[model samples]
Target: MEFLQPTSWTDALAAKAASPEAVPICGGTDLMVELNFDARRPAALLDLTKVADLAQWDIDDGSVRLGAGVSYARIITELSARLPGLAMAARTVGSPQIRNRGTVGGNLGTASPAGDAHPPLLAAAATVEAASVRGTRLIGIDEFFTGVKRNALAADELIAAVRIPLPVGPEQFSKIGTRNAMVIAVAAFAVALQPARKLVRTGIGSAAPTPRRAPAAEQFLAGALAEHDLWESRAELPGPLLDRFGDLVTAAAAPIDDVRGTAAYRLHALGVMARRTLAWAWRQYQSASPEGS
Candidate 1:
C-alpha cells in the first residue's frame, strides 16, 4: 500500500480524484483497529493528518466549528467549559491513548450508531461540511447518519469540519454501561434546556439504529414545564408522563441482545438517564440564571 500525505486541501482533493478508491485517513483510531485485524487493506491511503487547513477550529456568532482532526483531549480540556455536554461526551470516549489519537471526524466517518459524539452533536443541531474534487456540501447531523455503521458521505469526499449551533441554555450528557470508563455504552443520553423558547431537546444513542431524538418526551416536557418558571418543576417529571416517555423512547430504540448489553437493560437505562439528565440540566439552568430574575 502507498501513503500520500498532502499539506493542502487542493492537493488532497487531487490525490483523491486520481485514486478514487484510496482510503482517506486522519486519526487512525478506528481504521488502525481494522487494519490490525486484517479486516481492511486499502491499495492506497490519502493521509489528511498533515493537512493544515483541516485542523483549524473556531467559534463565531454562537456557532462552533471543529476541524476534522480535532482530538478528544482538546475538546475535553478546551471546549468543556464552553460546551459542557459535548465535553462530557468526549471525556467518556476512550482511554488517554485513544483520546489522544481519536478524531471527531473519524467517529462521523465510521458512522457507528453508538458513537459517543453522535448524541451530543444531534442535540446541538450540528452540521457537517464535506469537500470533494467536485465541490463542497453541508449536511445536517440528522441527515448524516443513514443507518448502523452507514453514512451519506460520497466515495470521493472528505469531511472538512463540523459546525454546531451554540446552546441557549444548560445542557448535560449521561451514559450507562457495564464498566465506568473505556467501555462501550449500553445507553447514552444528552439533554439540552432551551428556556428562552420553552423547549427541551433530548438525544439517545446505543438503543437505536441511529442516534435519535425523544420527540414525544420532549413534547411532554415542553407542555409540563411551560407554566412553571423554576427548576423545581423537574421533580414532577417522574410521574405518569415520565413512564410514558420512557416507553416511547424504548419503542424508538432498535436494540439487539449484543455482547455488551441486553436490549432490556438498554431500554430501562435509557429512560433513567433521560429523567436524571433532564433534572440535572434544569438545576444547572437555574443556578446559571440571575437571582430574583
Candidate 2:
C-alpha cells in the first residue's frame, strides 16, 4: 500500500481531495490493528501525525476546539478541567500506551458502538468539524454516527476537530467491562448536568446500534428537577427518581446479543451505569460552590 505524509493542514486537505480512498491515519491505534489482521487493505494510507495543526487545541468562545489528533493522554492531563466527562472516558480507553496513541478522532472515524469517547461526546453535545478542499462543515454529534462502524463523513472529508461546550456543571462517566484495563466495555454511560440550562443529558454506549443520547431519561430528569426546583436547591436526588431515570435509560437502548454480552445484560448494565453516573455527577454538583467554584 502507498503511504502519503502531509505536514500541513492545506497539504493534507489537498492530498485527501486528490485521493479520497486513501484512509487517513493519525494515531493509527485502530487502523494499525485492522491492517495487521488484514481486515482492511486500502490503496493508500494518509499519515496525519506530521500535521501539527491537528494536534493543537484551543478554547473558542464558550466551547473548546479539540484537535482531531490530540491523544487521550493529553486529554487527561491537559483538558480534564474543561472536559471532565471526556477525560473520564479517555481514562478507560485501552492501556497507557494505547491512551498515549489513541484519539477521539480515530474513535469517530471507526464509529464503533462500543467506543469509549462517543458516550461523553454525545452527552456533552459535541460537534464534529469535517473538512475537505471544498470547505469545512460542523456536524452535530447526534447526527454524526450513522450505523455500526459507520459515520456521516463524506468520502473526501477528514475530521478537523471536535467542538464541545465548556461544562456549566458536573459530569460523570462509567462502564462495565470484563476487566478494569484494556477491555471493551459491556456497557458504558455518561451524564452531564447543565444547571444553568436546567438540563440533564445522558449518553449510552455498547448498548445500542450507535452511541446515543437518552432523551427520554434526560427529559424525565430535567423536568423532575425543574418541577421541584432541584437545580437551585441542590438537594439529594430521591431514590425513586434515580430509579425512574435508570429505567428510562434502559428503555432507550436497542442492543443485540453479541459475544461480549447478551442484550438483556447490556440493558441491565446501562440502567445501573446511568443511575450511578447521574448520582455521582449530582453529588459533585451539590458539593460545588454557589458560583461553581
Candidate 2 lDDT, 1-293, residue by residue in tens: 99999999999999999999999998899999999999999999999999999999999989999999999999999999999999999999999999999999999999999999999999999999999999999999999999999999999999999999998889999999999999998999999999988888888999989999999999999999999988889999999999999999999999999999999999999988988998998899889997862
Cα lDDT for residue 156, model 1? 84
Stretches of candidate 1 exceeding 4 Å from the true structure: 227-241, 290-293
Ten residues in a row with the worst lDDT in model 2? Answer: 284-293
Each prediction's RMSD to truth: 2.2, 0.8
lDDT of 1 by residue, 190-287 (tens): 98877777777777888888888878777877776765544444344446655665676666677878988998888888878876787677667656
Clashes of 2: 0
- Backbone clashes, candidate 1: 0
Q: What is the C-alpha lDDT of each candidate?
A: 0.82, 0.95
Question: Cα lDDT for residue 15, model 2?
Answer: 98
